[model samples]
Target: MRTRFRARPRKWGPLRGLLAAAAVGVLVFPAGASAVSAAPLAEQDLGSRLAADYEAAFLTQYNKIKDPANGYFRQFGDLLVPYHSVETLIVEAPDHGHETTSEAFSYYLWLEATYGQITGNWEPFNKAWRSMETYIIPAQKDQPTNSGYNPAKPATYAAEHGDPSGYPSRLDSGVSVGQDPIANELSSTYGTNNIYGMHWLLDVDNVYGYGFCGDGSKNAPAYINTFQRGEQESVWETVTHPSCETFKFGGKNGFLDLFTGDSSYSKQWRYTNAPDADARAVQVAYWAKTWADKQGKGSQISSAVANAAKMGDYLRYSMYDKYFKKIGNCTSPSCPAGSGKNSAHYLLGWYYSWGGADASAQYPWAFRIGSSAPHQGYQNPLAAWALANDPQLKPKSATGATDWATSLNRQLEFLQWLQSAEGGIAGGASNSWGGSYGTPPANSPKFYGMAYDYQPVWHDPPSNRWFGFQTWGMERVAQYYYVTKDSRAKSILDKWVPWAINNTTVGTGGSFAIPADLQWSGQPNNWTGNPSTNTNLHVSVLNKNNDVGIAASLAKTLLYYAAGSGNTQARTTGEKLLDALLGNTDSKGIAVPETRADYNRFDDTYSQGGLYVPNGWTGKMANGDTINSSSTFLSIRSFYKQDPDWSKVQSYLNGGAVPTFTYHRFWSQAEIATAFAVHAELF
Candidate 1:
């Protein structure tokens, strides 16, 4: 059953001192707002190790989210190198669904972002580039615009085969990432892992991330200095995109977008997938606006941004005519506040600048607390960061650069809510283990949105106030405190530290636990899933996780907190967690999960393993296979940034590509702004 640390699952015989090791001192803390820690170890240095285990788990295991074809990437079919691809990975995964390349790519980016933060370098993040090279070959295309070591194709399908002009995304099968071992565990064929449910993985970098590292890893190839597009297949040269001249646009035909492939040969392919007229318009408008903003001759911002704005206007118009129009905070059967298409409404609010420049728009846009299931209490860092850093305008004008205080407060509120005064949190706040894994009242409709809980059912629905009822609260909670030193942040700081200190034994901190960890608090119904048999295969692949979410993220927070204190004990703990994450994901001898090769799942991984390794089983895909990896292992990024000892992180950065993480900074600023920026930046 899902147990809360604050309440400690009552039957667990009082989890006393289970987190005492994380506490700075021994003192029972009170509830909410104004606070004081009796054992506040204000002067300590933990490092990026806080989230180490969880980080490693995310990177390696997340790759299994894809259903493998013939147990290898189409290109890497026969080229499976022992230590690189096959050595560390379990080959057998239950295939129940298709794997989406886009989703895998997004997950890859997520890991790179965090890894880059630890070392402040971008080279270690080259795994995404390599994936593209082996999979989509974006650089091999003749259309120069889409060049580089990036996943450009999600796999093409016949447009007329029972598919619509745009609705057949389901039929599209994307082949990316590596094999899934979960299916083997479940005795299913590799074909069970579908490759179609991964369409939304496209252009996610544009929406959220840009480059391999925080600076712009998505579209910008900062990690690799030499681009073939800029110089035409010359590894030593920079790649460039198509400047003009395109035969694909307008006209009611099934034309496709052209892109550069990564292979040495110049290539070209027609993306026959149904065109998203609206999404395409947005892309075009963005380009036009950007071009128009460029001075001196080649200014195409008007065509790009303006066009995008125009398209946005059209979409907005459609929205306004339909499920929009704000009224007084009225709750009704018809006017559901956060009902139909929540993201769509969010966009509308952004265009209106939060209600024609009013409080309603600003609040939800930046920091409206999520009071429902899935997302409860925690504010969207995106809104907060945008408010504090928007070039267009700050969410709050008066506060401006001086600071975004409210955002900071909200962060503190959420962070505090995530922690248990005794230590850790309701279930531990690692990023890998978010609040969704909690117990709901007996016979509830949902437990963190899933149909069934993993453990035995719970007795009550999670109230999840503030941070809400979370399964992995302590994991990410500590990082929240370390990033922003809120007045009450220490309480959280103390709570997660002890957990890390006690859990790690140098090489042990990782996404390693049991299949039961699937629904961290436990699935609503006791889950008996395996790596390959379950519908989603990721959980099985990254089965033996590093628990890096909290440990790695917390390590860095601990280090920064302990920096000047010169605390040797804290330093040792930080270093231990750091090494643990590396052991968990650094397959290439580098402290980065971007090294896909060195991180193969293990033999037993056929049973289930962490970072997709050790679960160990490689089987072939048969007819009608549908299962795929469940949880993503791309979260090791938090490990690098959360440890006290960044030696390996530094070593990796000194050499390869790694993406920088912008979440903390972005979120911290937003929280600060929400609490204080609106008053100043609004005008």
Candidate 2:
């Protein structure tokens, strides 16, 4: 039921003509390597050997991502936005292939940053930030009502439900909510009340046709969102809506009534920020600054770095609990509302959100941080370190650096607390139990008074099931360890690296296998006390796969750990893994065949784990597809039926063979490209 795009084996598909032309750059090999060398690469030194391969790998992947003909990016007015994938029929995080996420934008920045590091060109990196700002981050025109935001009363409380049938949670003004601690400081520091952060989702092709603020003109790259119901509500069950709601689409109150129940619904504009993506952008900026400085070109990126600092300053919102409630053993909605830093968890939660009534409306705006500090995949210690230590990237706000400095240590401690007996990190801790501030079971494990959840934020397929989170989160720790020789970070990665390498397989003939899925058991002891090792906590590898993106991430983690700790097997495994990945490369990017049996759920009804529309709550998508009790995932957006890959999915729906696809996801490609650069630079 949980169908967000995870790292899976996928096949290559033909490109779709999606954007205007841009000149293709030729690959510039490093000085020590030849354009046509017949000599065996094995004979050369590691640096000389990998320099050519890494440069070529980075350039090939970069050109594939940037070139318009490849269909990875599309021209959105004056700016550009990358697609989720080159194909149109895929289903994952974004329902449609053309729909992009902040994750993609961050990866795009990373791709450009690597290019600047390799080619010494910083224009592309700056341009990436500009595009991110112009498209994803809501402009003054989009928000238009931050002036109405009240720091004293941020947002009213709404109890979260476990399923879609829990008809729009009613807003209760009587519930106590905390004040916005940093709102005034951030506004005074930046001279603006408007948040300077990227909203998590965008419809790059406007496939659903919810044009800007529902003015009705179909436009590309319109802001949109899904996944609001609860942990059980996966992408397959979502009812898409525009970010700037104007009551012109969906039901009478736009799509607001479907998610929240109130006495009177007001037309509004809202956006959710995926903290990990924004954090990754800052992490990328730090690397960009470091690389550029090495080439005596740091000044060229100073402006962009400053903006990253600004974004980081706003990112502190993620440190607070949702509704700004006190962090600890509060088991009810009546739990004490926190003031100042008491609400700060110091860990990056899943998301931070803000919204306001239309600029003309009388109602005020609201902001909320996430209460669930779930998936470790979202943590970025490197970025936290940069914001805390690097003067260039230090946030301009008064307490931003201090907060990040505390966050750096806290994140490391969180990692230490979550590590399992077998060394795999467990899920996470949550201040708001079950997302409603409900009482947790007595004697439940706790981390700093917050309850431990094996699968924190979401529960469809279990949030921490995929091994990708381990590698993704550990890679940052490894990098932080490699840079600062932080004993805490090293101590954590020392156990994680060996466990990951033990599960990974790098064989001859381009054959390789890394952890695909994981199964966890037991829980860590109370970290509020002495924080002992989790002797009872354990993990088992459920499966193995050659998912290129995850493999690249695992390799990076190992390489960084090996580089810092002098672990020979880690270095060899990382090098061999990278070498194996090159064999999977193609014209568009690296991918392998994926058989999508999950596509069968496209037509499933509510009982079968599909979209659940409340009876009589009739509405329509932009294309006029009706939304009611009978609607399935495919029924609401008829546009997908016209996709070129529709027939294969259709056949599968009709009980035929499962369709296999090779997708070129923007974020995965960027990760692969950067993985090569990471190897070359560190080695």
Candidate 3:
């Protein structure tokens, strides 16, 4: 009975919410109904263009200094500005002439590090790192075909050709929530090659100090040999696949390789001139090292040892030699639909679960990487963390142990074929990349009530459709109910944590690289599926709506990591939705900042100041800036795990005080390891 996902659930039939406010009311939205005003070159002309690029941005420590719009304004406008608002609401009314070189380089790096960590003034972090190096431009031509580093658009380049049912390419390519021509073909096919070159070395080590912004004491191996010559020319000419071996092409290894000869990457995801899954560098290391590193735990143990050597050969040759390939004396089923053990549990669960990385080199029960699975309804928390770490993944089976029990019994039958009749887990819209990849209608739908809200395995998605498939199925079932406590995953985490805190548009107004999946076209997750049009994304199913609650902030960070961490009722329900997120500038001498930008329109001071470095602690601290999607970095790590308890590891072992976007790897390693694996299954 591999049928597994039978379906039927949909409920929220108009006006009703508070099962937890659809996963804890929008984590980032300071003011809505589209406020309006300010037309730019103003607001003190962006602090006078950061006082004219403040001495090459104090040479780099203050960070930004040379981008100029080709690099999407310092990664979505200066590191997604003190929590994004499209520079005081993109010219009013439903957002006029929208702005985003990545939200104007995150609003010039929060106006020079929120006025240089509060009036100490590195001259507004050296003029907001030179107004985030005027959105860093360069590749307007040079390498012609595709050499990498490509971020140009602030002329708002609106061509808009995308909705051929290929689900959501920013709402089928009507394309212009301000710049996303498939991120310039994902920076010329996965950033000039070197496939995910550590996500363009985390925007050249957070705007030039070095790569993936690490090795920094202000990095120097001559800056890792001048950024490994753009990471070996983006891994030998634009990720055509030159890690040398290990499957060719890029993304889904460009249509499953029989190895059709000579490669520059391109095996599965797509490339015979590229068709669907635009594969925006299939999340180059989640946004390369979880939002430009330097937040704590020693760069989280050097980003979990280079994410265990980039998923250590897909947990040893795609789940221990392709799930024993038919089993001993074997010779068959190598790639065919096994899809290299579910693409190594979907890129090691978005890079070791947001780089807090649960180690042993991520191999969560590796049943040939959740083989023949994907119809959608959930099961890819990076292949259930390598099939729940199948005893311990690796190739030790020639003897001396480690056969991984028939691929961990198909990894608990692919997580009970991605459950749904209401018990939760709905990411099953399977297209394993080849032909007819079925199963994903929010994993099947019809689960008895909620008017059968199945719709989310991708119908229309250029941004936040299917809430990135229910935030990738509640981040692979809240990291499998925090590492297998499994009381039926704590009774579907108690009815999917109030159906994702009362029903969905995700934490309210925090989305940027949006795409939640659920559109055949009528459109209305509060409507802005902005893929260029009067809109078109719906795939059918319908009912519940709660303004698309970040798919209920993944059950409000899995009931605040099952109520163990900082839990005073999920930090007074995340400081009462961060105090109903009004129009920015709350200016209490700005410090405890966070953002959730939707602003294509809305003004009258929609908050600007920055310096949000929280977690285990670092300096000035920040959080807001919510939309590079995946439900705006998982609700900015579930709004800093609220903080009623573990006072960030008891104020960093006592010395106390911390939060410049503090120690977070998805709220410090997968939300306190799912709060010690669902601490005694509450709910």
Score residue 340 of candidate 2 by CA lDDT.
84
- lDDT tens readout by residue for model 2, 1-683: 01122323222110110001112335434333234321223434333465655665566667677777889999866567899899998887788889999989999999988888887878888889999999999999888888888877878888878777885889888889888799999999999989988898899878888888876677667988887887777778888888878888888888888888988877788888888889999999999999999999999999899999999999998888888888888799999999888988899888888888787786666554545454577789999999999998999999999999999988888888889987899888888887789887777788767988888877777888878889889988988889999998888887888889889887754568888888999888888634357898899998887888888898889889999999989988887787777667666777777777778889989989999887788888888999888999999978888989999999988889988888888888889889878887887
lDDT of 1 by residue, 170-210 (tens): 22223121121111221122122111111111221122222
lDDT of 3 by residue, 362-479 (tens): 3211101112123333323323333234322222223111223333333334333333333334332212211112122332221111111223222221212244345434544554
- Model 3: worst 10 consecutive residues (lDDT sum): 222-231
TM-score on alpha carbons, each prediction: 0.32, 0.94, 0.24
* Model 3 C-alpha RMSD to native: 24.2
lDDT of candidate model 2 versus the reference:
0.81
Q: Which stretches of candidate 2 lie over 4 Å from their true place?
A: 1-50, 528-531
Could you give the candidate ranking by TM-score, starting with the highest? 2, 1, 3
- In model 2, the number of clashes is 8
Q: Which structure among the candidates has the greatest TM-score?
A: 2
Error of 2 at 129 (Å): 0.9
Q: How many steric overlaps are in each model, in order?
A: 249, 8, 188
